[model samples]
Target: MQQNKNDLQTTNKTKDSERIPAIRMFNLEDESSAFEIGSIPILMPTDATSFWASNKTEDWEQKMHPAPRKQYVVTIKGKLKFTVSDGSTFILEPGIILLAEDTIGEGHSWEIIDGNEWIRLYIPLSADADDHFIAENIG
Candidate 1:
C-alpha cells in the first residue's frame, strides 16, 4: 500500500511539472528586453489588481517600448509577431499567454500578422505576486 502511495505521489509531481503554453518578455542584464519560449504552471493563481481589454491603434505595429507594468497579456483576436531588443521574434495568438515583465529599458514591439485589429486584455499583477514562469525544454 505504501509503495502504491509513493508511486501516486511521483505521478502527481510529474503532472504538476507540466507547463501550459506561455511566452515571457523580460528585461535582461543589459537593461534590454528579450523573449523566452517558456511556460507558466498549468494552474497559477495570480493576485491582480484589475483587468482591461483594448483594441490598439489602426497601425497595429508598436515601436520599441517597455511594458507599462508587470502584467499578463491575452490576445483575443488577431495574430501578432513580437520582436525584442535582440531581434528575437515570436508569433502569438489567442491560445497563448504573454507574460509581460519588461517594464524598464527598451522592451519589445509587435505587429499584426493576421488581421487588421489586435484586441487583448491586460491584467496587472500585484507587486508581490508570483509570475510562475519557467524557461525550459522548449526544444
Candidate 2:
C-alpha cells in the first residue's frame, strides 16, 4: 500500500517533534543561492499576506531566477527537482515545504519530475519575519 504523505514525512523528522520536511533556498553573503535541508513545525503560526495558488508554471521556472519574495511553496501535487546555484539539488513533493527566501540572487529553478500538474500554494511571508526553518544538520 502507498504510504500517506504525512506518514512518509514522519519517517524523516526529529524524534521529539513532528515537523514537515522542508528545504530552504537562501542567499549567501556572496549573493549565491544555497539550500539547507530541514523541517518546520507542523503547525507553527506566522504572518503572511494574501496567498495564491497555481497549477501552471511558466518556462522561466525551468531557468534560474530569484524568488520574488520570501514565501512558502506548499506543493499539494506533483514532484519536482530543484537545483541551486552550486548545482546541488533536492526533490519536493507532498509532505515537503519549500521556503524560498533567496529573493536577490541566482536563487533556484525546478522542473516537474512526475507527470502530475504542479498544484501549489504560495504564502508570502510578512516582511522581516522569521521563517522558522530548522537546519536539521547544523552543528
Candidate 3:
C-alpha cells in the first residue's frame, strides 16, 4: 500500500510539472518568435515608471501593430484573440500574463472577444532594461 501511494505521488508531481503555461513574448527582432516557458516565481514589482488599470470594450480588429513600449499586459477579466506578426495566435483569457516586447516594427494585433467589458493592468518595462533579462533574472 505504501508503494502504491508513493507511485501516485510521483505521478501527480509529474502531471503538475507538465502543466506550466507557456508565456507568449512578442519580439521586435524576430516576428517568428517562439513562446518562452521560464521558471520565474510570481515577482513582486520593484520599480516602475507607471501602471494603470482600465475597463474597456473596443471593436478590436486592429491591424498588426507594435506596442508603444515594452510592457506587461495582464488580463484581469475577459479575453482577446491575439495574432502576432509571425502567424502565431493565442487566446488571451483572464489571468493570462503577456509580456509585450514587440515595441518596433510589425508587432501583434488582437480582437476582443468574450464579454462586454475587459479589465486589465498595464505596466511599462523600464527604459534601461529588456524583457529577456528581466524574465531570466526573476526566474
Task: Estimate every model's Cα lDDT from 0 to 1.
Answer: 0.86, 0.88, 0.64
Q: Write the per-residue lDDT of candidate 3 for residues 108-127, one digit (tens) a residue.
A: 78777887667889888787
User: Least lDDT summed over 10 consecutive residues: which range in candidate 2?
Assistant: 11-20
Candidate 1, residues 47-107, lDDT tens digits: the string is 9979999995634238888888899998899999999998989999997889999989988
Q: What are the C-alpha RMSDs, in order, of all predicted structures? A: 4.0, 7.0, 5.7
- Runs of candidate 3 exceeding 4 Å displacement: 1-22, 28-40, 57-61, 130-139
lDDT of 2: 0.88
Which has the higher lDDT value, candidate number 2 or candidate number 3? Answer: 2
**Candidate 3: lDDT of 69?**
77
Please provide, for model 2 over 1-139, each residue's C-alpha lDDT reduced to its tens digit, 9 standing for 90 to 100.
Answer: 9999998777756553677789999999988899998988867787886899999879898899999999999999999999999999999998899999999978888988998589999999998888988888777
Q: Which candidate number would show the highest TM-score if scored against the true structure? A: 2
Clash pairs, model 3 backbone: none
C-alpha positional error of residue 115 in candidate 1 after TM-score superposition, expressed in Å = 0.6
Q: TM-scores of the models, in the given order? A: 0.81, 0.85, 0.66
